[model samples]
Structure formats: structure tokens, C-alpha cells
Target: MRVWAHDRWPFPLPPRHTYPQSKYGLLRERLIAEGVCGPGDFIEAEPVRWSELIKVHDVALMGRIRRGQLSVREQRGLGLPWSPQLVERARRSASGTVQAAYAAFQVGVAMNLGGGTHHAGRDFARGYCLFNDVALATSRLREARLAQRVLVVDCDVHQGDGTAQLLRPDPHAFTLSVHGARNYPFKRIPSDLDVDLPRATSDTEYCAALESALATALTRDGYDIAFYLAGADPWEGDRLGTLGLTKAGLRRRDALVLDALRGAGLPVCVVLAGGYAPNIADTVDINAATAIEVAVRRTSIDRGGPDAKLALEPRDAA
Candidate 1:
């Protein structure tokens, strides 16, 4: 399996924020150590081009961000204090998702160590998201004929409102978001397939709903590719998550998601969405476990060899 990552790309999260040592990072390290991927498996990802940003993002807004010129109001809007490094981190995160999609095209699955910035919008940014990678990646894939029908499965605790709004009228893509009924992005947009779960939903029920939704996307909707935003905040210990799933339950959650795609012979690109726990290590560990689960399953099927790499992904960066 091919997994995409870059060292020193995150925004240098605060120690107490619980986003710094996120499990997705650990999962990447764990997957490498566990033989899911050799050292050579990871390839450096290219940053997204300005033209790609123009495809779905606002031109003036893009121009402002490109110059590291966030207005005083804009700074407060995204919450994090602005910096060039933050800009670089956001760009890399966006491109990482694209690279992961390309990697999945080469293999049955690819993991993006950081991405799924779905809260970003065409003309604005919010909730730590500076750009909408899902929209950018999907556009690149469709433009390259890598996928005729793309399905975005966003399972983050917060709804992929930005992605949903951007792709709402796009016929080539299908946006499916399963999130907490009352969470971030209080005003939710309508996704092509929206499933809002109640607070404190059990693991069994959550997995059941996930399976059904994925099944419908792969089998009935007939998507050529799938982009999964596997957020770790669904865990019970998450500082911001309202769901009540345990760590093991979260693993089973990944199983249900990956199993659906693998069973349908669909290639998938997975991203780290969000996870804010009281402990930064736990948050990081949680994200890592989710990634481990996806890689473990992907590597198993991928051992069948190169034919398993037929999943198409976007190749063009510009």
C-alpha cells in the first residue's frame, strides 16, 4: 500500500489543545513499524497549485491568503493566530490529500497523515481549516478523468459543511457526511447523503449506520473512487466530540468503513479529520489507531500485489 506524508507539516499546535500529538501521526509511525509499509513506501507530497485553488476557491480570498495577508478580522475568524508556517502547513495538508488520492490510484488505498480540512469554504476559512482539500482533490480527479463519479465520505464529528456547500450542485461528485447532530458548523448544509447521528450513539448503532451508508455509496451510487475523512474525535474521551465510542469501538468503526470499500473493490484515500481530547497524546494516539486500522486492512488486501493498485487518483498538481 502507498501512504502519503510529510514531516514538519502540521501547524505546531498548542501543547494543551490535544491536536498536536494526534493519533493519526502515531498511526503513521505505527504502520511503518508494524510492516504495513516499508521506508520506501512513503513519497513526499507536492503542495497544491494556485490554479487548483482557483478552481473551487474564491480568487480574491486566495490572493489574500497567498500573500500571508490575513486581515485582523480574518485572523480572528479562523481562530488561530496567522503565520507563514500556518499557511505552508495548510497548503501541504491540502496537497497531501491530493497525493494520497494519487497513491490510492496506485494501490487499493492511501493514507494522508493530515488533511480533511472540510470546514474551509470558497471565500472563507473556519475551525482551523484554511482550504477545502476535499473539493480541491475531487476537482483534480475529475479534471484528469481519474474518476467519473467520486464519493466523499466525511465521518468527522463536525459536518463537512464547506465541502457539502461547494459540491452540492456538482453532478460528478457525491458528498456523504455522517456527523453529530449538534456539533461544529452549527448551521449545516445539505450533503448529497447526510446522516446526522444523535449524541451518545452506541458503537453498534454507529457502525450499522456507517455500513449502510457506505454500501449505498459504493453499490448503488456507483462511485468510481471514495475519499474518506476518518476523524478521531468520535471517541468518548475527545474533548470536543459528543459521540460515546471507545478506542476499540473506533477501530471497529474503521473496519466498517474500509471493509465496505474493500469489499466493493473501491480505491480509497483516507485523511485525518479532527480529534480534540483532554490529553494531546490521547488525541494523537486516537488518530494513529484509526490510521493503523485502515493501513492494516489495506496492506492485507494489497499483498495480492500490483493489481490491487488499480484505483485511479488525480495526478496533476496544476
Candidate 2:
């Protein structure tokens, strides 16, 4: 499997910032160390072109971001300080998802080690997301004639407000977000299908809701590709997430989503979304498990196995 990563592109953040910037690099390293991915399988992502950004983002917003002209209020809403490096990193991170989407056509699945910036809208940036990468990917794919119908399965703890805002109007795209009803960006934009789970929802409850939602979302056929935002923040230990899912539960969540997408014969592009465990290692473990699940499924599809089963079964706990 080919994986796109942009963790090498450093961005300035204030000391004690809560964005968990280091988790990207940590997740990449853990994937390699655990033999789920090899060093050669990783691709360094380049900054996406302004032309692509304009497809999903407003030209005025792009200009302000490029010129570092964001006002104090805008920066506060972005939840990160603006710098040349930050802008570059955002472009590179978005590029990872775009590249992964293209790569998924060659392989059954591809991944971006750092993406899922789902909170950035056409004219606004918020929730630590400067650009809506998945929306951008959907637009680019349609422009390239690579895909007409697209599916976005966002499993992040927080709603994919930006993605919904941008893509919900398009009949060719379907967006499904299963997030905590009480999480950040409380004023939610409606997705094509939104499954709002209560805070502290357990593994059984979350998984059941996700399965039912996927069934409903998949009812609309003709999707050429799928983008899965497999966020790790739903873990019980996450500082930002109030859900009561264990690492094992998160793994099960991955299996359910991946199985559904792959079963539909849709190429999958995976992105590591939000995860904010108090111990960064815990976050890394969850993301790595996701990478491993993707790799296992890819291998199974390539080998034409009878069943695309997971090589590493879900453990009871982290």
C-alpha cells in the first residue's frame, strides 16, 4: 500500500499548544516499527497547487492565507498561529489526501498519515483546520473526471462541518458523519447523513449506530471512490473526546467502516483525523492500528482472498 505523509513539513505552534502536532510523526514511525508499513511505502507530500485550493476554497480566503493577512479573529477561529510554515504545512497536508485519492485507484486502498481537515470551510478556517482536504479532493477528482460520485465516511468525534458545508449541495457526493452530538463546532452543518451519538457512548452503542448509518449511507449507489476519516479521538482516554470507546472499540470501528466500503467495490482513501489522548503514545497506538487495518485489507484484496479479514484481530483493550 502507498501512504502519503507530510509530517516533515514543520509548522510553528505556541508552546503548550493542544493541537497534538507531534502525533503525525509518531503515527508514521509506529507504523514502520510495527511492520505494518515500510519506509519505502511512505511518500512525502508536496504543497497542493493554488489552482486546486480554489476548487473548494474561496479565492479571497486563499489569498489571505497565502499572504498571512488573516485578522486576529480569523487566527483565533483557526485555533493556530499563522506562519509561512503553517500555510505550507496546511497545503502539504491537504496534498497528502489528494495524492492518496489518486493512489487508491492503483491500489485498492491508500492512506494519508496527516489529513482530515474537515472543519475548514470555503471562506473560513476553524477547529485547527485551515483547508477542507476531503472536500478539495472530491472537487479535484470530479474536475479530473476520475470520479463522479463520491462518498465521505467521517468517523471523527467532531462533526465534519466544513465538508458538509461544501459538499452537501452536490448531488453526486454523499457525506456521512458519525460524531459526538455534544462535541466541538456545536453549531453543526448538516451532512447528507449525520449520526449524532451522545457523549460517553460506549463501543457497542457507537458501533451499532455506525453500522446502521453506513447501511443508510451506502443505500445510494454509484460511488466511484470513498474517503474514510478514521479519527482516533473517540477513545475513552482522549482528552478532547468524551466518547467511552476503548482502543479495541476503535479498531472494531475501523473494521466495520473498511469492510463496508471495500465490500461495495469502492477504492478507499484513508486519512488520520483527530486524536488527542493525554498520553501521545496512546494516540499513536490507535492511529497505527488503523494503518495496520488498511494494510491488511489491501493485502487481502490484492491476493483475492476469500474474505478480506483482519490479520490482527481487535484486542480487548489498549
Candidate 3:
């Protein structure tokens, strides 16, 4: 039930910025307001030590990003203006995922309110991502001897190209990305398992594909932890997402993933990925639904019973 986040996640950006930075705050507030999470459920993201960050990121890239010395081309690829606040936010977000992973080892499940930066590579950032939080966390966890094997379930509309490439040669980490086939970063990197859906794919099709992918991933043994990129961009209303999943469908999607992970007795660290609906409220609603679903299921699993049905209430209250 521990959710890591930081106030600086929503840095002051100029009006009309393409990235929906405000959604992070809105999702956090809505989760509390809707009784899905209590004020105590939140944990501020601590800054990640350089020693840990260097485990996954290139030292030169890290140095430039820290000093705000990224070249114009590098900054352009990052898709975020260089700022001291931005650097700090990226660091915190990376740390937040690591915290969530550690917390999940204690609890059945944990979350990072602003993570899933899968577009960030070891050497560079792209698509508004400065650090591959999940990748860095995976490396840190392995280095700490916390987990022997890891699985990444990326459901974002855009392919987790960076994550796939970063972990391509890593036998200990398994990457499974189910994303829009023709989405951004057209050149897709091969993951351990990739389920590319056609444009305008329906809810049933996406779920079926996901079920197959989950089954395949579960076939492997000895995975100690799972990092789920529960992206909300697959909603039909999303501006960037071409898929056509309804809100209810998206909720079902959340249940499917959470139930599978928790049912298998694996620790899961959930991260909110991309969600850019034309109506920001729609995006917020989808992300909130994910939080509620994970919180509910985590409680049920912790209580030593069947996977909890999606009741959308805090564990103590339930």
C-alpha cells in the first residue's frame, strides 16, 4: 500500500506543454479523495544516490544531466527543457521506483505515482523521459541482492524501446511489452516477448493478447519481482493512443494484470506510464482506477486470501 511520489513531479511548465505533467498531481489527489488511498499511504521520493544511478545509466550521460550540460540535440531527444528542477525531479522519480520495488518486497504490492519512464535509455533520454526508472531500479535491486530475476510488463501505447534495448542482453530481466505497433519510436526493439497490437485494436483483442502474453511470461520460473507499466493511454479517448479501449475496459485490464501478478504470489511494483486523453479528466480517471485496483488487490493478498475483487477502498477501511 506504499505509494512513492514527490511534489516536484509536476514542475512548473509553460502553458501548452505537450506532456501532461499535471496529471500526476491530479491522480494523487483523486486517489485520496475517492478513498482509494489515505494520506499516510504516500511516501516522498528520496533522491537516488549517484552510486545507484550509475548502475544503469552511463556515467557521462549522468554527469551531463546533473550539470545541465546536455547538448541541444540531447535535450531535444529528451523532449524536456533542461532545468535544475527537472534534474531533481528525474532523480526523484528514479528513486521512487526503486523505493516502490523495495516496498513491494515487504508488502505484496507497491506503486510509484510518477514513474514508468521506459523511453529513457542508458545513454540518453527520450519522449519526456530522463531516466529509465524501472531499468535503474531493476539494476539496483539486483545489485542489492533483493531479487534474482525480474519481469517487466509494459502496457503503454508506445513501445518500451529503451527498456527492451537496455535489458536486451540481460538474462536476469525479462521484458514484455504489449503496445501499439505503429506508435512513436517507429523502430521497435525486440523484447523477451513483444505483443504488438494493430491500430484501433478493440478491448477484447487487447485483453486476449495480454492474457496470452501473461501466460507466456508466467511459464518462466524464478521471477522474484514484477514492474508493471500500467499506462492509461490505451483508452479510446487518449490523444496520442490510437487504440480504442473504453474506460471500463481499461479497468478490466488493470484487474487482469493485478490479479495475475498477485495471484502468482509475486511482488509487483506498479508505475503510472503514459496517458494523454483529449480530456485530461479521462486520463486521470484511468490512472486512478489503476491505483484503486492495485491497492484493493494488494490488501486482499496481504490478508492471506484470494485476490481481492476491485472494491476501490483502502485496506484498513475494507
Using all chains and alpha carbons, the TM-scores for the candidates as numbered come to 0.88, 0.93, 0.92
Q: Which tens-of-lDDT digit does each residue in 122-211 have in candidate 3?
A: 887888898899988887778679887899999999999889989867888889999988788787778899888998999999999999
Q: For residues 1-318, could you state the per-residue lDDT of candidate 1 as single tens digits?
A: 456665555566655553453454565666677776666666556667888889989999888887878788887677776677777777777887886776576666778878888888888887888899888888877777787778888988889988988887888788889888878888887888988889998888888888888767665557778888988888887777788888888888887888887777778889988888777666666666766677666544554356334323233353
Worst 10 residues of 3 by lDDT: 309-318
Query: What's model 3's lDDT at 153?
Result: 94
lDDT of each: 0.76, 0.85, 0.82
* Alpha-carbon deviation at 68 in model 3, angstroms: 1.3
**TM-score leaderboard ranking:** 2, 3, 1
Count of residue pairs whose backbone atoms collide, per candidate = 10, 0, 0
Candidate 2 overall lDDT versus native: 0.85
